[model samples]
Each structure stands twice: as structure tokens, then as C-alpha cells.
Target: MIEEFVREKILNTYAKRTTKSKELWEAARKVIPGGAGSGFRYYEPYPIFLKRGSGSRVWDVDGNEYLDYCMSFGALIAGHAHPKIVEAVKEQLEKGSMYGIPHEKTAEYVKELLRRFTAMDMFRLTNSGTEGTMHALRLARAHTGKDKIVKIEGCYHGAHDYLLVSVFPPLSKAGPRWAPTLYVHGEGIPLLTVKNTLVAPYNDVEAMETLFRKHEGEIAALIMEPVPMNMGLVLPKQGYLKDIRKLTEEYNILLIFDEVKTGIRIAPGGACEYYGVDPDIVVLGKAIAGGFSAGAFGGKEDIFSNIYPLGHAVHAGTYNANPVAVTAGLTCLKHVMTTHAQSQMNDLGEDLASGVKAAVEDTGFEAQVPHIGPSGTVYFTDVEVVDYRTASTYDKKKNWEFWFSLLNHGVLTPPGLLEGGEQWLVSAAHQKETIEKALVITESALREIK
Candidate 1:
């Protein structure tokens, strides 16, 4: 009855406030699948339509302003419409947007990326994280001369068919915890793709080793997010990464750290620097380009030489390293996301996490906030979520109610938080006061839901 009451109350409130968004969703659904461009952008009833954003805040079509903790799913780590990004885009626009030929800024961008990601000796850009991971996997397979690859359960590298297995499998069909059955995330994934992809649980080194031993000399790489953000910000167990690195080396399998969500948001050098374990390749996107559509993959010079114009593996894109994206990314990484900005965002993340933890204790709510640097999420379960299996214990009803309550209170989290696949990101533009305000709103929402 309480859950029903909460849902009804929130739904009614949401419908009244977002009437224009409803109309837009109706129109969009007539043309676009599911009334939104991306599946993650849609929610029950309808999704709110936004007009514009600036500096950690977004305004909806209805003229309602929200403190944007979602930060465009951590893609806007420097915050929306940053002055530096705008200036760079304008300056680059004068020259051109896309050029199929090599440009100076592309080299500079790669150089900058290498400077931060010291583990990477060479780099290449792509249009999105999907392309980066796709290319990275191809490189891995080519370099190792193997077809099969391993993916951690619940880790989402990209929408590519090769790594789309077991992202959010139903526990009933997921088999044992240690060795999970590879459940294709969608219907269109080829059977051959599923056969080539393997599944392993997170935070368990023994299980991974079992998989490695069973399929020795078969796997090309083990692709994973260093801090599994796709499963509501799960943290890696202490020394788990280092052990995985050692294991991969022993088995002669390439380790690909998918840092699309964690690259710029977690640390300057991302998980590689934070964990101090270099993988064979690293895929980066999201915040790396300061909200532009860009992704990159890089590693040792020897491994990267597998790409075309050198080796047989072909990686090419018309929009790859477009001047607009490169200029924006260069500006963001070089000027905006400075050490001071990184420190400020990290401090704000800690503050927000601590505040949420305190709020949970005070409200007697069953929840845990796992955080690192500028990313975290409030899982509505008493258990600390170290992996996808534990993360599944979160009460979906409570999460939906809480998320709706926050939206009603002018705090925007990732829409997919209701489905336990997203996390809140603190941007450099986020001030301590805004974090404090968000905490107050979160506490109120938790109390109401409870």
C-alpha cells in the first residue's frame, strides 16, 4: 500500500508539472522507438524534456531548474556549456568541423591523452564509447590471435554485440554466481557472438582464474570497467585490480580497462593511475571530451600497431578526431579540468556521499552509498554493493520513489538509476552549497519514501 501510494502521488505530481514533455514524448514515440533517442533516457509515464544547461544546472521545457547531478551521464564532467569549451568550439568552427585528413589538433589531443594516461603509448579517437570499445576488442583479438573474450557480469562496455552478454541477466537464469551463463542483453545478438563471449563475476579472483584455466589459450582479453559504474557505481575490492592484472599476464590475455565512465571523472589518469595497474588497452569516452561526442582507445605501441596502415585490423571512421570534438576535448582536459578542478569535484563527491550516508542512518533507511572521487550512487539495500549480484538486492520500488521524489524536488539524477545501471556524478562546476542542498533534498526524499 505504501509503495502504491508513493507511486501514485509521484506520478500525479510528475504528470502535472511535465505536460509539455508528455506531448513531446508522444510525438517522439510516433517516430522514434520508445519515445526517446536512447533506451536509458526513457522512464515510466514519460521522461522530462530539457531545454538547456549551464554550470551544473539544467532547465526543463517547463522552465523548471534542476541541480544536475546526472551531468549527462557523467559526460559533462566540466559541467554543461563551459566557457572554455564554447570558446574552443567557436574558434574551431571558423576553421572547420570535420576533415577526413589528419589535423594538428588530433595529434595534440592524442598527445594530451598520452600525457595523462602514461600507460598508453599510442592512441586513436572515435565518435563514441561504443566505437572505442569495438575497436579496442578488435585490436585485442588481432594482437592475441584469439577470438573469444571475457566480460565481467553486469559490466557494460558498449552496445556492441561482442560484449553485450549478461549485462543485466535475470538471476534465475544467470546460473551460479562464480560462473554465469552468458545471457545476451537483447534479441539481435548473434549466437556466434554469444559463443565467443564469456562471463565472470566481479570482485572474485578465484572465479576469474577458474574461467581463465578452463579456457586457456582461447581468450583474447578480459574487458571491464575498473570501477563498474554501469551497475550503480560498484567499487573494486582492495587489490582486486592488481590481482586481475597479474592473472591476465600469467594467462597471456590482454586486459582492457573500459574507462568510458571513469576516465576523467574518477581521476586525471583514470583507473590505471588510481589502481596503478596498467592494462593492455584502455577505452575512454564520456567526460574526456567535455560533453562532445568522442571516445578513444590506446595502449602499448606494439599492440596498437595492429590497426590499419600498419597491420591487418582496420579501424576507421569519418567523424574520428573531428576538429570540433578534438578542440573541445583539448580545451577541457588542458584548461578546464585542472588539478584544482579535479580536487574540488572529488571533495564535493566525498561530501555528498558522507551526507547521504548520514541521511540514511538518520532516517533509518536501508541503503548504502559507495563512492570514489566524483561518482557514487545510493543503492536502496542494506548490503554494500561490491558487484552486480549484490547490487541487484536494491529495492527497485524504493529506488524509483526516491528518484522521482528527488526530481520533484529539483535534483536530477541519472534516469537509469531507477533500473540500477547509473550513478550520480559531481562535476567541477558543482559547488559545495549545491551538494549540501542536494543532500537535504535526498534526506527528505528518503524520509518520505520510508
Candidate 2:
């Protein structure tokens, strides 16, 4: 009955407000494989084709406006089509978009990044987070001369084969809580790739230590998201990160912090600074380019000295440091994303989390909102989600109803909770009034769900 009611509401609302989006999806499917550019963009029934976005709002093809909390999967920390980013891109457009040659803005941007993230002594740019993690892994392997790598279960580094294992494995196939089997996330990933990559439970230091000892000298590095955003923003329990740092050092293994999601959004220095633990290498992306396509891997001088043209671990890309992206990034870092702005966003996020929790309690729903900085996840379960296994146990059906309810009520969230739980992002443009309105909508949605 609940599913029926939710489906009816969604279908009716979608039909009334997204007729043009439906037509666009039909046309898009003729050319685009899934009627969308990315797999995650597609949802059941159809996705509402976006027309434009500005500040904290977006309009669909059929002219339906929504308070966008997805925020391009937490990439647009400065919010959609921010004026500073727009002006920077416009200025760069007159000069050039891409210059297969080195540009001064690239140097300036790197300097700015280094200034913000003091732990990184040297860095290199990539077109995407995948490239950054790929290069970081290669550098780690080259530096340690080890073939194996350990990654926390449920942490998504990217779509690369090396990090794809055990991302969202079924519990039946997933081994033990402590020792998880390296189950490949998708097909076409070779068995050999799975063999070289090891899995460790998130927030489990003893399990990590055991795994490290088991792998011994063969392991190259242990890469992880310090905050584990992919698993619905799971935080590092008290000493989890510190323990991991100590274990890596004791085992003579390198530590790589995949800050692709947390970087620049959580803090200027990212989780490294927020948690006060610096890894040997860090991979960053998303807001780093001010909503443009960009990624970067940086670390101590000794570690980066092993990269191409310096020590031989080749990392090459044609569009690594495009002028437009560099300009936008520089502008965002220098003018827009100041310490004050970040603090404001963090406070807004906390407020939203508290509001959602209150709504859930008032509505008498079995849910929990776990948040950090400007990002959070709504777990439709009573249990606390500390790791992937707990995250997976969430009531996905109820969660979907909650998501559709929000959509029907003119709020935009991720369509589905992939490996991670249902995530919501708060941007700098999200004001107190906007948050209050969203809370009202959330309470209404929770009431309907109940």
C-alpha cells in the first residue's frame, strides 16, 4: 500500500510537471544508450531533464523548479553557475579553452592548491578523479615496488579496475566482516585485477592491521576516503584514521587519501586538515575545478619525485591543465571559497542534518541522518551505519519512497543510493531560508511516508 501510494504520487507529479522532460528522454534514448550521459543520472520511469541551474535551484525541461541538494553529486560547492566561476570562464574563453602547451594559470592554480593544502609539496593535474587515483596508485606501486594494494570496502575511489573490487558486493559473496573478499563491482574487470587488490572494512583498524600483516611485503599502499563519503558520509571513528596512519608507517606501506569527494568542500585542506591526519598522497577532484572537469594528485616532494620526467612512473594527459578549468579553479579558490564561506556552509549542513533528524522523529520514521561538513546521507533504518555492511542493510524501498516524496515536493536529491546510502549536499549558496524551506518539505515528506 505504501509503495502504491508513493508510486501514484510520483507518477502523477511527474506527469503533471515533466512532460517535456519525458519527451527529451525519449529523444535522448535514441542516441544516448540510457537516455542520459551518465548511468547515475538515470532513474526508474525517467529522469527530469534539466534546463538550467543558478544559485541553489534548478529548472527541469517542463519548467519545474526544484531546490537542488544533489549539487552535481557534491561537485558544485560554490553552487550552480556561480558568478565568480562564470566570469573566470568568460575571461578564459577569450584567451583559449585548451592549449596543448603549458599555461601560466596552471602554475598559478597549483600554487593556490599547495597554499590551501600544505601537506602536499608537489602535485600534478588530471582530467578526472579516475585519472588522479590511477596515477596515484601507479606512483605508489613504483615507489614501493609492490604489486598489491588495499582499499576499504564500500569506498569508491573511481571506476578503475584496481579500485572497483568489493565496492558493492552482495553479502552472500562478501566474505567476513573483518576479511572481505575482493568481489569485482562489474564485469570486464579481469580476475587478475581482483587478485592484486585487497579489501578491508572501513573504520576497522584491527581488520586493516590483520589484512596488512596477511599481505605483508606484497602490498604497495592502502588508499581510502578519510571520511568515506561513498558509504553515505561515514566518518572515521575517533582514532580510525590515526590508527591507519600508524599501521601504514609501521608496515612500511604508503597511505593514499582519496579526497575526491571531501576535498575543498569539507575544508580548505579537506579531511586531512579536518581530521588532522596527513597521508603520504592525496587524490582530489570535483569542486577543485569550480565545477569543471578536473582532478589532481599531490603529496610530499619525495613521493612526487617518483613521477614521470622525474623518476619514471609515467602520468600523461592531453587535457590535464586546460586554461578554462584552471582559471575557474583559481577564481573559486582565491575569491569565492574563503574560510568564512566554508564555515557558513558547514553550519548550514549541520542545521539541515538536525532539522532532518527532528523531522524524522516527529514523523515517527525509522531513519537517521549522518552528516559531515556540507554533505550527508539519510539512512532509512534505525541502526547506525558505520560501514558498508550496515549501510547496505538500510530499507531501500522506504528510502526510494522518501526520495520520490522529496522530488514530488520540489526538492532534488540523488535518484538512488548506489553503494552509498541516500546522500544530500548543501552548497555555499544554500541560505538559511532555503534550508528552512527544505526542512518543511522534508517534514511533509516524512509524514507522507509514515
Q: Best candidate, TM-score-wise? A: 1
- Over the stretch 1-450, how does candidate 1's per-residue lDDT look in tens digits? 334525787778778889888888899899998888887887777789999999999999988899999998989999999998999899989998878899898888999899989989999999999999999999999999999899999999888888888999999999999899989897987898678899999999999999999999999999999999888988988899999999999999999999999898888999999989899999999999999999999999999888888899999998999999999999999999999999999999999989988999999987888889988888888887888899999988888888888998899999847384898999999998999999999888887778
Off by more than 4 A, model 1 = 1-6, 416-420
* Cα TM-score of candidate 2: 0.97
Q: Write the per-residue lDDT of candidate 2 for residues 1-450, one digit (tens) a residue.
A: 334435676667767888898899999999998799987788767789998999999998788889999988878888999998998899889988889998888888999889878888988999889999999999999998998999999888888888988877899999998999888987998898778898999989999989888888999999999988776778778898998999999999999999998889888899888888989999999889888888999999988889878899999988899898888888888888888998999999999999988988888888768888888878877888889888887877777777878888889987764324447888988999999999999998888767
TM-score of each: 0.98, 0.97
What are the Cα lDDT values of the candidates? 0.90, 0.86
Q: Over the full model, what C-alpha lDDT does candidate 2 score relative to the true structure? A: 0.86
Q: What is the lDDT of residue 141 in candidate 2?
A: 94
lDDT of 1: 0.90
Give per-model CA RMSD: 1.5, 1.7
Please give the distance, in angstroms, between residue 25's alpha carbon in candidate 2 and its true position after superposition. Answer: 1.0
